[model samples]
Target: MADSQWVDWTKTTQSKNYRGSGSFATFMIVGPVCFFLGILFASFPYDFPLLWTSDPVAPSYYDQLETHLRFVHQSPPLIARLLNIIMTVGFLGFFIKLFRPSEANVLFDGASLVLYVIGAGVYIANIVKGMRAVSAGVWHTEDFKGIAHDGPLTGEIVLGREDSLRVLSASNTILALVLVGVLVLQAGQWYAERREAEDNKKADQADKEAAERKASASAGSGGSGKKRQ
Candidate 1:
């Protein structure tokens, strides 16, 4: 009976989508975003003072700022490239799954992809632009103009430095929040899939028990007839 039940369960599971593999693919897509989130969080201490404080930029701050800027310049581009590669792979997998004749939850994958694209868009549109501005040291010439500048210091526009830093910090904050949203969406997908698997398992068990009871009743009826004869 146990063996029969196991065989029935295996067949039932095989008839459905390969959800475990799908979930693994989804994680691969999300993994880099999570890493980016960690980077953003870890930089808060280095970023907050430069962004929020009204105190004059001390000469000593330049060293720390340079270190932070160097990291900002180097890390994100690599991370973004990695993210793009992973997203491409994920999309390929999604298409393959969609074409399969199984009951795959394509909707979840579609929604996740949409959210991830939005997050990527946000990063590219805002964060990447900010990074470029910082790298070129040309923030004052772009964007807002109505705000009065603090005038030049050390033969360069001090306000531009502040503005670029602000842009970088603000963009990072927005990207971090967007990544959080992506994480939440993935979490919900995982939970829904888990619940679905449990439900399927229960249904399979119920069907197996019903089949066993029906067989037992038929056997009993046949024996009773033989005894009467």
Candidate 2:
């Protein structure tokens, strides 16, 4: 009976932890999607006109491009920093869970952590680096010969800047999708484990019921034999 109680407690605690982690993973997934959507909304004003323009490098056209890039450089880092903090906490939680004796789904947790780390790597390598480059005036690098030059930027320089922005946006969108995939994996694992637990509980209850029935039958037979004697 004591052993059964312990097993029940363990299963209950494990189920709670699994559900909590799944909820956290859902939050992580939502963060990236919202960030990407925000970027699209913020850039739409300039991007829409630029998309239809024939001369993207013209002073008038490139000025709007610069404005867009400036917004990208300035706005995203704040949200990125916040997301990074949340991700770091999530990573540490999972990492700690890896060594926990109570954690039954080691493979599932390990796989989720691996994918989470990969997503972080992509963010740092592509998204973070791209933003830093934009902040450092990538457009004026060649024209100003590594010196800071202020004023209207035009010609191929603006075109290069536009291309970099596109690449940055694309990479960020991909990263968000990858995070969503991780969330899906976590959800699936949680469902599988929950189902397994329910099945185990049912099996245990069935065995207990069968043993009780057998004991009652034995007691009835013993009483009848004594009365016959």
Candidate 3:
């Protein structure tokens, strides 16, 4: 009967821990996706609004094969806009997950939440800027010695896009740092909990052993008393 009760209690504890772990699970999943997408978006060649009017470099200063390389590669504008929106969505999802209650300490959770929120906002702002540039029909650009603003974008629009991109670069860095912080804090929490569990298990075993010894002693005493009687 005691063994069955022990098993039931262990199952109950496991279920509780699993339920409390949902937020951590969400972090593990969404955090990597957001990180990868952020890096990929940042690495994309054409995130700014610029236009290439001529060859990338002087043909006279380059070899024949190098001179033929076009700096301005045309891409589908609609597809680019769609991808920007998708990036916004990804950041939004990541931000939402930050608020999910986890097993971390309150301070650690709050710090992670603040950092993640800032990062998500910055990334979304960058995406929104790109979307605006795309709508203005001037987001595609390439590396050229004589790069010009040939697209239908104003100076303000271009500046805003550039500024947002720069800010997002910084934000991505912060987000990566926050990921590390969250992992460390949660890992510590898990470790502490595990240690407490092991300690409790040891104490329970000691108690059970002591109880068995007491029972054996009592039985022996009772039998001796009976024989004496």
- TM-score of every candidate: 0.63, 0.62, 0.46
Against the true structure, candidate 2 reaches a TM-score of 0.62
The lDDT values for all models are 0.62, 0.61, 0.47
In candidate 2, which residue ranges exceed 4 Å CA deviation? 1-66, 75-81, 101-103, 140-159
Residue 191 in candidate 2 has what lDDT?
80
Please give, for residues 1-229, the per-residue lDDT of candidate 3 as tens digits. 6554312233322344432224454455345545555654554333222122343543343232112212111345675576556545544543443333333333444454565565556546654454344344442344322324435574333543334334434444555555556456555555655776798899999999999999999999999999999
Runs with alpha carbons beyond 4 Å of true place in candidate 3: 1-18, 22-114, 125-168
Q: How many backbone clashes does candidate 1 have?
A: 0
Highest TM-score scorer: 1
True-structure RMSD, every candidate: 9.3, 8.4, 10.9
lDDT tens digits, residues 120-143, model 2?
Answer: 787787777776766777667556
Q: After superposition, how far is residue 12 of candidate 2 from its true place, in Å?
A: 11
Off by over 4 Å in 1: 1-24, 47-67, 74-104, 139-164
C-alpha root-mean-square deviation, candidate 2: 8.4
